[model samples]
Target: MHLPLDIDSVKGFLDPAEGRALHDAALAAAVRGPVLEIGAYCGKSAVYLGTACRTAGSVLYSVDHHRGSEENQPGWEYHDAELWDHAAGAMDTLPFLRATLRRAGLEETVIPIVGRSAAVARFWTTPLAMLFIDGGHTLEAALEDYRAWAPHVIRGGTLAIHDVFPDPADGGRPPFEVYTRALASDLFEEVLGVKSLRILKRL
Candidate 1:
C-alpha cells in the first residue's frame, strides 16, 4: 500500500482500487520469484507491483517498447499529445517510466526491458512469479502477448490482465478474449476481479 509515486501523477489507466489489488497479488506471487509486466506505459501499475515486489524482497521486470500502443497512437481515443515525440513522429513514454521509477525509489527493484513484447518474450527463459498483461488492445497484439508470456508464469503464480470487459459496451474485447482463452485452456483460474482488472492463478 504505501507507494512512493502518487498513482494519479503517473501516466496510464490503472484504477486505484485495482492498483491495490495488483500490489497484493504481486506481493503474494513474488514469494515464488520476480514479477514481469507487459505494457508498462508510464509505470502506474509498475509502481504498484514494484512497491510490493520491493517489500517482498523481490523485483519486477517491466516490459515495454515505449512506443505507444494502438490505442495510444495519434488520433486514437487514448492518445496523449504530451507523450508524442514530434521529432520521432511517434509516442515515446520511456522517459516518463524512468522518472516514475526513480521518483518512487524503485529503480533498483524494477528492471525495464524496452522492446516489442513478442521480441523480448521470445528469449525470456526465466519463470516468473507473476505476469501482468496490459499491452496492445488489438486482438492480434493481445493474443501474441498472452501466448508469448503466459508460459513463463510459474505454477500457482499470478497472471493479471487489464481492460477486460464482458459487456461489449464497456470497452474493447481483446483483453476479455485472452482472459477467457486462459480459462478455457485450463492453465489458469480467476482469483480476483476489480473493475476491469482480472487476476488469475496459474495452474
Candidate 2:
C-alpha cells in the first residue's frame, strides 16, 4: 500500500529531534479509528502522524481555520510570510494542507476539515485514539481547544500540544499555563515533553 504523507517534507518542517519523538510515540501507540490533528499549518505534523495512521490502519482528521493567527504570522520565521497577507483577508489554510496531503498520497487517509474546534466537535462522537492540538496560542483559544478535544480522546490515548513555551517574540503566553490548569483536574497524566512540548495520556 502507498504510504500516507510525504516523509521528506515533514522532516523539512519539524525539528529533527521533536519529529522523531512524536513519530516514536505514534508508532508505540495502538491507534484505532480516527486521529485528530488540530491546526495543520503547512501539513508538517500531519506527515508524522499520518504515516503512523497509514501503518496502523487509522485515519487522520486535520482541523484548522488556517487563517494564520497574529502570533503565527508575525515573528514566527517558520511560516510562509505571504500566507499571512492572505490570511489577513479571508483565506484559509485547508486548501494548502489538502494539496500537501495529496502530494504525499495521503488524500485518502487524511481528511481536512475547515472550522473552529467547537464547530468540528459537534460532528465527531467516536472517541479519538490520538489528539494533536496546535491551534491558537491565546489562553482562551488554547483552553477551548483542550476542553473540546480532551473528552474525545479514548482512555490511554495521547494528547499532544505545540507552542507550550513562552516566547515573547511569538506571544507572551505559553500553552503551559493552560496545561498546568488542566493537569490539576486529574484528567490527564503528563507523559513526555512537558516543558516545551507536552504529551498527556488520559487517566
Candidate 3:
C-alpha cells in the first residue's frame, strides 16, 4: 500500500527505510488488533504506521505527552528550537503532530493520547497487535516504557524499539539494553532490525 503521508515533511529521526519496515510490520500485526506507538513526534512514524493500519482497517493509538525528552530539551544535542512553545514554556509537539496527521489525512486512523506512556498504560486494558517504543531515550524512561507496555502486547504481537545502537560510540546504550533485556526475558523473539529499529515477536 502506498503511504498517504509525506515522511520527509515531518520532524523525526526515523529513516525512510526503517519507517517502511515499521509500516510493513504494523500492517502484518494489525490483522489481530490495533497498533500502539509510545511516541508520536510530529506524526512521522505515525504516518508510516498509521497509513498501513488504515489500509488494513485497523487503528493506531499514539501515546505521548508532547513534552520533549531529556535530549530534546534546550542545549541538548537533539534539541530543536522550532519545537519550543514559548507561551507554554515547554517543548510542545502536539500542534505539529496534529497538523501532520491532518495533512496526511490520517487523523481518523491514528488516535492521539495526550499523556505520559506509563500513566496511560496503567489504565490501558486492550490487547495490542503491535507496540512501538520510541518515547524517552534515558535508561530510566526507556525501561519504564517497556515495563509498562510490553506485557500488554498479545502473544505473537510485535514489540518494536527504536534507536538501538549496539556500539556505544554510535549512541547511548539504553535502547540497546532494552533490546537485550527483552531478548533475555524470553518473552519475545527477535525478528527484524532496520537500522536502529528492532522488532520482536511476543512469545
Candidate 4:
C-alpha cells in the first residue's frame, strides 16, 4: 500500500542503501510480537521500522534518551541548546511518526518509549520479535543495552546494531568492542552489513 507519508523525506537521517536493506529485512521477518528500536534519532529509522511493524501486525517500541552523544559531535558548541532543541524536536517527531503510520493505516501500531533502553525493558516480559540497537556507542553503554535486551528477544529473532566500527581517532572503545565480546558467549553470531551495522540471531 502506498503510504500518505513520503518514505524518502521521512528517512533523511539514514543512509539510503542501508536503510532500504534494513527496512526490507524488517518487512520480510515473521514478526509475531512487538519490535523494539533502541534509538529513534529524529524518527528516521523509526519511520522505516514502524511502517514495517505495521505491515507485520506488530507494534514498535522506540527508545531513546534523546541526549546526543559527545562522540557524535565533538566540540559541539551549542551542546545544551542543541540538546534542549533536540529533545523538543524528538517529542514533536513522535506525533508526526504516529500520523505517518496512521496515514498508512498503522495507527494501532508504534509505541514510543522516551527513556533509556535498560529502564524501559523492565516493564515488559514479552519476547521481542526484533530488536534494533542504535543507542550509545560506548562499550559500557552498548554492552549494558545488549545485556538488558537480548534475553527478551525470542529465538530466531533478529538483533541489529548500528555504529559498530571503531575509529581509532575517535578514541576509547566502540560498540563493536562490546558486540565482539558478546558474540564470544556463543549466544549470538554477527551478521555483516554495510559499514558498522551488525545483525545477530539468538541461538
Candidate 5:
C-alpha cells in the first residue's frame, strides 16, 4: 500500500529499521479494530502505524496530552525548543501532530486523542487490535501506562513496548521491566523483537 507522507519527514527517536518492523507487525496484527498508540509525540510513529492500519482497513488512535512529557520539558535532556509554547510555558505537540496527519492524508484513518493516556484509559472501552506503548520512561509512568492499557488488548492481539534497554548503561530500564512483567504475568508471550521494540501477543 502507498503512504501519502514520507516516513523520514516525521520527527522522533524511532529508528528507521525499527519503525518498518513496527509497521509490518501492526499491519499483520490489525486484522480488526484500531491500533492504539500511547505516545504520539510529533507523529513519527503515528505515521508508521497509521499507514499500516489504513492499509489493513483499520484505524490508529494516537493518544497523548500534547503537553510534553517530563523528559520533554524545557530543561530536560530530550527537550526540543521547536515544540515549546512560549506563551503557554509548556511544550505543545498537538499542532505538529495534526499537521502530520493532514499531510499524510490519514485524517480518516488516524484519530488523535489529546489527554494523559491513563485518563483516557478510564473511559476507553474499545478493544484494541494492537497497543503500542512508548509514553513515559520513568518506572512509575511506564507501570501506569501498562496497568491502564494492557488489559484492553483482546486476547490474541499484539502489545508492543518501545525503548527497552536491559543494560542500565544503554538506557533506562522501565520499559524492559514492563516487558519482563508482561512475560511473568502469563498474559502475554513474546512474538517479535526489533532493536529495542518488543512485540508480545495477548494470550
Candidate 6:
C-alpha cells in the first residue's frame, strides 16, 4: 500500500517494524472481514491496518475514548503535554488521530468509534476478521477488554496484542498476562511475535 502520510512523524508508540507486521496481518485477514483495533491513540497503528484494509476493500473500526490512558495521564511516564486539552482539563488524542487518517487518505476505510472499549463491545455484533488489543495497561482494564472483545474474532482470524513483555522490568504485566490468557484458553495459537507485539490466530 502507498503511504501518503509520514508514519515516522506520527504521534504514537507503534514501532515501524511492528507496524509493518500489523499491516501484513491485516492485509491477509481483511479478506475474511473487517478489522477492529482497540486504542487507536494518534492513529499510527490505524495507518498500518487501515491501509491494508483499504487495499482489501475492507474496513477498519478504530475504538478509543480519546482520553489518555493510565500511563498517559499527568505525572506518569509516556505522558505528552501537547495532547492535554486545557479547556476540557483532560488529555485528548481524537484530533490527532483524525488528522492522521485524513493525511493517510484512509478516511473512508477507517471508521472511528469514540467511546470506552467495553461499552462499545457490548453493542458490536460484527464478526471481526482481525482484532488488535492495545488498550489500558492495568490488570482489570486488560481483563475487561479481553473478555468484552476477544470472543468476536472469527475463528481463524487474527488477534494482535501489543506491549507484551515477559520480563517484569521490561514493561507492565497486564498485556503479557492477557497474551498468556489468550493462549492458555486453547482458543488461540501464536503465529508471530514481533518485538512486544504478539499475533495469534483465533481457533
Instruction: Tell me the tens digit of each residue's lDDT in model 2 across 1-203.
Output: 23354456542235645656665566555355578888887787777777778788788888888776545555665556545444355435656677788788778877888788778887678788788877777778888888888889888788877766656565346477766765897978888883356788778
Q: What's the TM for model 5?
A: 0.97
Q: State the lDDT of candidate 5 residue by residue for 100-125, as single tens digits.
A: 99999999999999999889999889
Instruction: Please state the error at residue 121 of candidate 2 in Å.
Output: 1.4
Report the lDDT tens digits of candidate 3 across residue range 24-59.
999999989999999898899999999989988999
Q: Model 4, residue 166: what's the lDDT?
A: 66
Q: Candidates 1 and 5: which is better by lDDT?
A: 1
lDDT of 5: 0.90
User: Mind giving the per-residue lDDT tens digits that candidate 4 earns over 54-90?
Assistant: 7787788878765555544435532333324454452
- TM-score of decoy 1: 0.98
Q: Cα miss at 23, model 3 (Å)? A: 0.2
Worst 10 residues of 6 by lDDT: 1-10
**TM-score versus the correct structure, for each prediction:** 0.98, 0.83, 0.98, 0.78, 0.97, 0.98
What number of clashing residue pairs does each candidate have, in the order they appear? 0, 0, 0, 0, 0, 0
* Number of the predicted model whose lDDT against the real structure is largest: 6
Query: Regarding TM-score, does 1 or 5 come out ahead?
Result: 1
Pitting candidate 1 against candidate 6, the one with the higher lDDT is: 6
The runs of at least 3 residues in candidate 1 whose Cα sits more than 4 Å from the true structure, single-residue gaps closed, are none
Query: Candidate 3 overall Cα lDDT vs. reference?
Result: 0.93
Q: Sorted on lDDT, highest at the top, how do the candidates line up?
A: 6, 1, 3, 5, 2, 4
Looking at model 1, which ten-residue stretch has the lowest summed lDDT? 1-10
After TM-score superposition, what is the CA distance of residue 33 in candidate 5 from its true location, in Å? 1.8
Q: What is the Å distance of residue 8 in model 5 from its true position?
A: 2.0
Compose the digit string of candidate 6's lDDT tens values, residues 114-201: 9999999998899999999999999999999999999999999999999999998999999999999999999999999999999999
